[model samples]
Target: MNQLSPNRPRASDQMWLDAALDLLVEAGVDAVKVMPLAKQLGLTRTGFYHHFRDREALLDAMIARWEDKNTGNLIDRCDAYAETICEAMFNLQDCWVDWDLFDAPLDNAIRHWARTDADLKQRLDQADNRRKTAIVAMFQRFGYEADDAEIRAMTILYTQAGYIAMEIAEAPADRIARVPAYVRLFTGQDPSRNEVERFRARHGF
Candidate 1:
């Protein structure tokens, strides 16, 4: 298991990991080389080595940190945002849009490096499975029965990301506009009419 200090007050490793993710979002994942991250954090190569065995170790750590944050807080954050169309996602689409639009492509670019780095790819797969499982549970919360919820949620997890790719490549708003359809499909509700609207109108469709 990947150990984390999530219940603790945070550590320099955590800061380094956050800085790395910031670099990922800002300059793409290729820029997350150990040397560059160490320099960005004012650490010498020796200092960086003390924390992570190498770039692969650092990448694994980064993925672990992201999963920790996601599993711990993502659902709560969506519920707190409970008054929007995404709230119907229970708003998961809202939570991940930024990452999918930006970081996921960056992650894909990093995968080219993964072909030569077995450990990084292994960690990546672990992180990917953890995220998929969490999202599936979130769908069950939206009222799908367990087995069906897992299937529907995985469809969104694996498939809707193409919309993010298309939006990034071409017509952004049109791509985003279609996202609610995915949530509706999973929830067995129609985007054109939801419980929120039904409540507002005091009627069911």
Candidate 2:
């Protein structure tokens, strides 16, 4: 008699969420429906039901995942210890370079989805505010005035966001070459040679 393997990988809520995110990036939110995700995962709809009550429940989980992992993690990284303002800026750069942590594609997908969903738009706005507030806090830690910190934080955040939105493709070497300039422009001081070299080494440039 044929028997199912006892060790077969069972589908989890995170697996469904990951599949939904992949579909969101590949085909947009419209294609993230339960049937499509189930087909993509090679599982039946019953697997999805075990994790999510409905499509709306799955969407809510996805949004929460985005907010917690992407937004909250970035803020935490910015708050990491650094010896100087320049070092702090470099620390934040780690968030930008590490795609797995920041997930630009998913961020962009959510922004696009927010266009059609008012509630999501409001949530995005709140996330944006929290991110900016965290950045400002980072600057203030370096003794920058509140007004200065706010302006500089906005400049840094918006510039990175714009780069991701424009989808500009550049070689690793090219981007590495420009990091010092970007850090200087954002922080009003150039990163030390050690800081730059450490960054390059981190990205294998």
Candidate 3:
């Protein structure tokens, strides 16, 4: 299990990682080489060596950053306090709208990268399973039965995965307008006006 860190990495380390991530997202992992990143950042290869031992080490760090920011924030949202299942769903949905909570582009990039790397593909599968487990637990905490919770968790997760895979785009207002209906469909219960308002407020909708 990878331990999640609350502390940010040093500024110089993050700078290299950021450049590598952009290259990864824009041109796939093949383009995220040390030479490319060094050129992109206008930094010498020596600077990269100061933070990472080699290209492979930098790649490992990239995966760690993705897992920490994306998966870590998701689990945190799943465990966020909520008085009802509707509210809880909203809390988790925060990941959909909040880039800080979920870096969907990075998630997409990593998923694509994993397609060619067996070890990374395994880690990606594990991450998905972990995310579903958290969602299932969240549902169970609100009185869902074991079987119902499992299916509900899968539905929510797979739906979002579909959105990401398809690169679906929608205006913020349009998506927010659909949230109440979506929450109802996912939870079998409509969110209260207060719960909906709170969800909107959090997203500045």
In candidate 1, stretches whose alpha carbon ends up further than 4 angstroms from where it belongs are: 1-57, 65-90, 100-102, 109-114, 163-172, 192-205
Candidate 2 residue 73 Cα shift, in angstroms, is: 1.6
Each candidate structure's TM-score, on Cα atoms with residue i matched to residue i, is 0.56, 0.93, 0.93
Whole-model lDDT values for every prediction: 0.59, 0.87, 0.89
> Which candidate has the top score in lDDT?
3
lDDT score of residue 51 within candidate 3: 90
Candidate 2 local accuracy as lDDT?
A: 0.87
Q: Residues 15-81, candidate 3, lDDT per residue (tens digit)?
A: 9988888888889998888877776766666668989999999899999999998999899999999
Poorly placed runs, candidate 3 (over 4 Å): 1-11
- TM-score preference between candidates 1 and 3, better one: 3
Clashes of 3: 0
Tens-place lDDT digits, model 2, residues 1-205 = 9454565456899899999998998889998899887777777887788889999999999999899888988898889898888888887887777776788888989999999999999999999999999989999998999999999989988988898899878776787788778889988997889998888898888
RMSD (Å) of each candidate, 1 decimal: 9.0, 2.1, 6.6
Residue pairs in candidate 2 whose N, alpha carbon or C atoms collide under 3 angstroms: none
